[model samples]
Target: MPIKAQMEQLQRVTSLSVALEWVTGCPDLAGRDTVLKLIGEEVSTTIQGVIYSAESKGGGGAEMA
Candidate 1:
């Protein structure tokens, strides 16, 4: 399949975790670097959100005024 079709299929069928796994396992996949970079950013953002939520609840962060 062409790159566009592969991407559309992924969007239609895979969740984020599954997509990441598929992309990692497919070394020859087109746009693999771009996909990995995007996935990394997504995971980083999710982690940041969780950290911020925890800190807001007094789990350890800057003092809340």
Candidate 2:
């Protein structure tokens, strides 16, 4: 499959949790699966860090008048 298809399916079929679970299930995965897993982890970790910082900072800098 192509990267285009993978991105589309990411929203529809696997979801982040399912992809992470798939990654954990295999230690020697390769190809598209590895690419998808890497992307997922990268996004997940980044989002987590953002949320943590926001909580620590209180209102996360999103305050509105």
> TM-scores of all models?
0.56, 0.45
Cα displacement (angstroms), candidate 2, residue 48, comes to 0.3
Name the candidate that leads on lDDT. 1
TM-score: model 2 vs. ground truth? 0.45
Model 1 RMSD to the real structure?
12.1
Question: What lDDT tens digits, residue by residue, belong to model 1 across residues 21-54?
Answer: 7887776666898898887777666556655665
Candidate 2 backbone overlaps, count: 0
What residue pairs clash in candidate 1, if any at all?
A: none
| Candidate 1 lDDT for residue 55 | 75
Candidate 1 Cα outliers beyond 4 Å, as residue runs: 1-15, 27-30, 59-65
Q: Candidate 1: how many backbone clashes?
A: 0
- CA RMSD per model (angstroms): 12.1, 9.9
